[model samples]
Target chain A: MSNQILIPKLAIVGVGLIGGSLALALKAAGVVGEVVGIGRGLANLEKALELGVVDRITQDPAEGVADADLVLLATPVLTLTEMASRVLPHMKPGAVLTDGGSVKGSVARAIEPLVPEGVHFVPGHPIAGTEKSGAEAAFATLYHRRRCILTPTAQTDPEALRLVRRVWETAGCEVVEMDVEKHDRILGAISHLPHMVAYSLVNAVSSYDRYEENILEYSAGGFRDFTRIASSDPTMWRDIALTNRDALLEMIERFELSLAELKEDIRGEKKDRLYDFFLRSKQSRDAIL
Target chain B: MSNQILIPKLAIVGVGLIGGSLALALKAAGVVGEVVGIGRGLANLEKALELGVVDRITQDPAEGVADADLVLLATPVLTLTEMASRVLPHMKPGAVLTDGGSVKGSVARAIEPLVPEGVHFVPGHPIAGTEKSGAEAAFATLYHRRRCILTPTAQTDPEALRLVRRVWETAGCEVVEMDVEKHDRILGAISHLPHMVAYSLVNAVSSYDRYEENILEYSAGGFRDFTRIASSDPTMWRDIALTNRDALLEMIERFELSLAELKEDIRGEKKDRLYDFFLRSKQSRDAIL
Candidate 1:
């Protein structure tokens, strides 16, 4: 507590919004020293350095995470395991490794085995982000007041778990622990399903074939705001869809059943039923927001 | 251009967010000498008066529209015809009668016949509003830089059309004239369909039956913003669903088809197809926004 930094050398791979923001947040909290930004995109890594998001930048995975106290993989979910395999061999024995992907169970199952003898793997998801990408979208307050779920198994070391929790808490997140499977299911219902719906809805309007070009222009604020999530990174969401396929498929089926019932209510001109249907959704949404 | 007001007296039935906002905008523009708020809810009517959204309040349709230079029916789409019938007899000769309902073809078909010999009917829809309702949600800038579409048929008076266009322009709307059926079709594709999708999606998440109580709490900003439209007034949306039934049903069918394709793509892990699907929507949305 006297003058020692919590993380003497922290490595952040991927260095986009989530990774860059975490480095900025940890630096702002003064809990991390010698932050290193690593990514395939040299431009983004350089920008992160130029913007003071990191103390150094690197394109090589081994060069980035070697000798670091903590190495965080913040790439798209599907790439996390491969990136881990590349960097784990070179990381220090006691260094803690984690990620900020939306899907957790698959990541935990795939990467837990790749952890070196003395290294620790803690799969985490910071329940935050905008429909934005790149280092320019990064900000120190991106994770403030947001929830961060860490999925730790029996193999997770207690010290590594505490350190990971401290890192997120210092970045202003309310960190919670849960089993990885339950995290995927809950996130599948809330986050994955909604993104699918938005994506599908926008695609629907675009391909309506009635009057294609100008239909979206007539969209009011409701439509514009509703479809904002569809603008998120395609590769990231596609990976989430693939990684959490079972849970997402289940959620999609449930949603289709609900939509079918409401469609029938509208088609039959069941005024009372329609009113009750909308009233229930309104009440439910109102309770949430 | 003299010191005379554009509309000596204006009567707005169903004084909710839309009607109240119009009144406030016109009053702020100093174009209406007096505004009358009429609705079944006396509390909202009084709130409109207190907020200076209107100069007077009335429950009786006859007393509200009598001797007014302009009468605007801003109620739900389904109730516009019945309201028009109730107030048609009391409106002074040469007075303009318009509405702020979302659907226009059905309203025009039903209400145009009820217009008194000397009265003029112009069906207008200002493409603006928020999820909030009632007079308290009214604001003068609600319509600024928004679009207002007036569907005027052959029976519509030239003077009445001019006056309605002027009123919307004064409220900072870019007024456009279109056929009633085309307006309904365009709005059905954009506004009504999106509302229905949001309503159905919220219902879907609430009824998932997996982890009902805590699922929504885990929702990130994307899910919350995506479902915000579901919190709109149920009765108003119900009326919209019923009145714009055909076009909305068609749009729903198209949406279901689009969703089914995306669902299949996810289930099969068609990475290229999924990426392309999302890319298409993102490009379409980016173009619009």
Candidate 2:
């Protein structure tokens, strides 16, 4: 194809939403020669194949990465430690390796030692996803008008970083790079902390004594709108929460302090204080909304 | 028109989102004779009339409720206390009075003494709204298939309670009744507490140093969805937090406890505990998602 950017053979570890969408987007752009999926589930990989998300499926990472010019780790944060050890050695010499996990600091630290000299390892996060998971949830347009943040370490090869950036850019993502540690703290505050609070808030209502009778019956769209992230993938969030523990904890503490101030304001019936707090929140949210 | 349920002369104070939507719904259903809007802003009333949300506009409660068959106090919760005292003297004898505020116990208590012996007074909360407010935000379908909760006290007039229920029912709401105290507690857990958490969470992110640089740049739909309620009316929420102070405080404590447990799970790297917590949250949210 004219004006096409090609990966001779692309290897995607974990052919679910992130991986499958990447594969679909690349294929739709005529930018990849072959896309191979390395995942545990045969049914899922087969479904990925049926949906044109992957050209082939393999149970072995070595086999999948043998001829891969690009090997993208599209798995959970905690799983990347093991995935790095398994996939890095098998990657072709001069191949570019990257990841698509939310917390980059841990992934960059965990996978750095495993990368061979010629292989370029860049940790990245695509800020796009639905509550839905699995290969069936893949969509070529998932990354369109979205951001893909690349967190490349000092060891990253310049050419490899450029190629990785092109891949996401070609997939219709606006790519920006940042320090790995900064990425974790950023994602932890905006993404992970909000997720934790949404889940906990829903759980608080769920476990309340009169929830089923009192709370659930009176729940309107506002509650639903506020807690929709509670429906996110459980295991995925657990891994994210753990992998980004320190940052998440710091964010949680800060959030708790804010909540405490609000509680005290309510306790004191401080209308002015309460109004200021609410107005600040509204202004902040309004900017983005 | 034979089986139509009509409000012969309905007076709606504070023609904002709730009042405007109620008038729109009633008008669409051919169930209201003449709706008079009483709001502080003449432009808002004019807009409500333009949108066909109200048939008439008036500045004075005495003028609006003079010959009304029903007077819906659609003002902010804190204002409802003074509004009840002001409007009750103007209502026709035996006219039914109700409200569309989120908090029930306080409004019911504040207005109970002011309500004349011949008049029926019922307190209510229509568990429906959008982030947008004002007369312009009203829609004819805002209450469709939604629940309208009536929190009638022991002193509430039975005929007024029935009539208030029918008003919401005629607007296409599924009506349910609960004790005033119970309604506050239930709504505090599900609705009020969730809103508080959302606003606090957003404020936390907004107050963070270089948040626009570090956080907002990478925000995904998940964060946006979870924080949408943070954009709700500032004064309305401040009033909600104060009027329902005790119940909201109790609910906030319960929510804080839940968040603490989660934080502990993350800090301890208790994978199983974290997984279970997320799973329960997912299950709870799944039932409603």
Compute the lDDT of residue B155 as modeled in candidate 1.
95
Candidate 2, A271: how far from true, in Å? 0.6
Docking class for model 2 is high
Runs of candidate 1 exceeding 4 Å displacement: A1-4, B1-4
Q: Model 1, range A201-249, lDDT digits (tens) per residue?
A: 9998877666545678777777889899999999998999999999999
Candidate 2: tens digits of C-alpha lDDT, residues A1-289: 2247578789999998999999999898889998999998799989998888999999899888998999888887789889889988877789988989988887888889888888888888999998888999999999998999998888888898999999999888999998888888888888999999988888889889864453565688888777888888988999999889999999999999999999999999999999999999998888886
Candidate 2's interface RMSD, please? 0.9
lDDT tens string, model 1, B125-234? Answer: 99999999999999999999899999999998998999999999999999989898889988888889889988988988887766545578877788889999899999
| Residue A222, model 2, lDDT | 84
Model 2 TM-score is: 0.97
lDDT of 2 at A119: 83
Q: Quick one: best TM-score, which candidate? A: 1
lDDT of 1 at B286: 83
Fraction of the real A/B interface contacts present in each candidate? 0.80, 0.89
Q: Cα miss at A136, model 1 (Å)?
A: 0.8
